[model samples]
Target: MTIPAATASFHGIWPALLTPLKPDLGIDLHRFGLHARALVHAKGCGGVVPFGTTGEGPSFSVDERRDAVDALVGEGVPASQILVSTSCAALPDTLALTRHALAIGAHGCLMMPPFFLKGVSDQGVIDCYRQVIDGAADDRLRLYLYHIPQVSGVGLSRKVVETLKRLYPQTIVGIKDSSGDTAHTLALADAFNETLMVTAGHEPDLPELARRGSTGAVSGLANFMPHVVQRLAGRPDAPNTPHDVSRVRLLLAMLGPYALTPALKGIMAALSGEPGWLRVRAPLVALTTDQMHTLQHALKPIALDVDVD
Candidate 1:
């Protein structure tokens, strides 16, 4: 489970990415790679992850993830540039995933806290990470802690990063601040300025973060909207940057709230010309006909290319 010394850099605009699938619900690893290659080859996309929350990461089996990584890397994307999110429910599973990712030559892996229990203490969260880092035995295993407190319930508390950094400076590495808390991220930027790369998960906040010496984002919008991601990412520190950010927010507004997920899946389906692209895994329903009608009304005009024709 040792991450090679040669593979430690995790940077830039990595779309949390999605796993394209056949209508039959079979894993379309080939189509997945096609999407990956397209993103990797795109102007602003740094790399991709096959099984993120956006990728329906929880819904995939271990074998599917392994094959997905292989397929993407084989398509000419380098191993280091492709960061695999190994965020699972249990410690053993997380360790296995971490090791598997290391074996497949993923540059780094992301981890989510054990979400089965609510109101977890920071120590428990710390122990979970410590166990993963220790078990992997990979000094070069760059671990980006997923900080979506809303979903995970267990926030990786303010002290956790410092403790992890001290214990495993090279291995613990950075964080994906999806907490959406502007003040929290701002504090992190102020405190851990040079220590770790703090990525602003929200695009609207990127310009402000970039000004504060924060790194880029790990955005879902980028999965389907790569060109937009590039434009927003490259908005730069200048007077007119707010205008660009507002334009993106306007797009997000037009796209709607929950529309992001289905619409994103729709984008892949449309692009692949596989209209029966996928149905969200059971317990998670796909958009109804009326809902899709709403999507059609919303996306096409934005030049989002949601048509499968």
Candidate 2:
């Protein structure tokens, strides 16, 4: 399938980076920059997404997030390459974050509907975004609706997306459907196609989604497996290498035994040999000793060169 010129611009792997924490649990800005830089330079990533779900976005204060973005851009990562997820439950915070991203010349903002109020009316969802768009009052802002009902408890209905696009045609550019439902993913791709950039959050569907007109990914796994994702994103017609499928299987195996964030941090620690990499904020703890041992054992096989010691 021919990718639209607009969609093609954003097509490639954008890793949802893991925010490495200091031993005192402070934001490790230097380590964060290193990670983001490595992804772009070494892993050949399209861009880096800071303060998304995998980066523990909700756990940090606005200042912390702002500082992290500062660190990333300060490291010479272009604003055109950084897509910031500014999806706060509060309308004011969301606006503030998005405004900051735009002010810094970020490529765009990935926003989730106000997810604090469960069972919100469709109009309520629409109004929340409307307030931000109108409040921010920036024509330069490119907004991508983030759909991850499983995590956010707020789903981006097709009607909501269509309405936003109809109202703010140029501003509303895309949707990140992390719904992880293939049927829903296909439905969104079929409905929006070139009109709106539909990036699949489900990594495995990337190849098929690419074939069906979906453009790129804002993937968590891409943080650790950027080259694997690069290969996966190569072309829809290409076959999945054995390495790709096995790597994905290895990641999935970790999910059942631990929370994804901690597991990912644990794996990152194994790769970087930095114990502080395992620290997480309150309400999210480090992996258990047994889990770490097991994760190291399991990861060694998949990440052959990584020192799991």
Candidate 3:
């Protein structure tokens, strides 16, 4: 299939969307679409990233992810505005998800190494990616490597990323570094600034990274605070002020104690006054009543600043 000219380069803030679930714990396709549209049009996000770490990508089945993508696009969010993460423990499953995203016209695919089996050899990592790129073998496939060692336990070494870029220069485009280390984010930009599009997960460092040639971010904080991320990304030379930085940090601090996905969902629920937002899939639990009250208290200033309903 002739792919449309690459839909906008992978630059600017792309929120790692927080999946909204129903009471039955099924994906809430309606709320999902609403969130995508609001983030892009209202909050000024360049686009939306579904099925990333923040979106709890691995927890949902391939069918659910596919449906969510279709729902977002059907709701009038352009396919170019969606960056789908297709990281699964199984290769066939990953290929299926990647192919589906490409067929549907997503901006690109953010992929991780087969992370379930940790301690994989370097060559093993390369070959794993090779199989997916070669297997899908589609011209439209724009793959962005995902390197969040803290969660995935599989870090894409510089050598691995460089080799892949050398091998699949067109198909393998960039990476989302969620390593949470400024030095590592800076080094990746320094090394591959010209070739690879590096997006930092650390929101505070986005402006500096952008100045250093990194493209943008796939940020968790942007789920609620896209304007902050957008403002920082839109003006790379002028970083966010200390007050802006503190506000972002405050939200991070408040949510840091709880399991992140649920805490975020609770905050969303409280802000929107939609109880369904608190529903998470198995292996994840919602915040307790006490915790919900606490999150509300801490996030009050941020909620006012963001002007959420």
Q: List, in order, the clash count of every candidate structure.
A: 0, 0, 0
RMSD to the true structure for each prediction, in A, is 3.9, 2.2, 3.2
lDDT of 1 by residue, 3-101 (tens): 223332544678887666677786777767776777777544777766767778777777777777888888877787788888778788778888988
The models' CA-based lDDT, in order, is 0.72, 0.81, 0.82
The numbered model that scores best in lDDT is 3
For candidate 2, the 10 contiguous residues with the lowest summed lDDT are 300-309
Relative to the true structure, candidate 2 reaches a TM of 0.94
Checking candidate 1 for backbone clashes, the offending pairs are none
Q: lDDT tens digits, residues 140-209, model 2?
A: 8888889999998988888999999899988888888888898998899899876888887777777777
Cα lDDT, model 2, residue 183:
93
User: lDDT tens digits, residues 14-73, model 3?
Assistant: 889999888788898998998898888777777899998889999989999999999999
RMSD of 3: 3.2
Best of the two (1, 2) by lDDT: 2
User: Which 10 residues in a row give candidate 1 its minimum summed lDDT?
Assistant: 1-10
Name the better of 2 and 3 by lDDT.
3
Cα shift from native, residue 304, model 3 (Å): 5.3
Which stretches in model 3 have alpha-carbon errors above 4 Å?
1-8, 237-240, 301-304, 307-309
Q: Estimate each model's TM-score.
A: 0.89, 0.94, 0.94
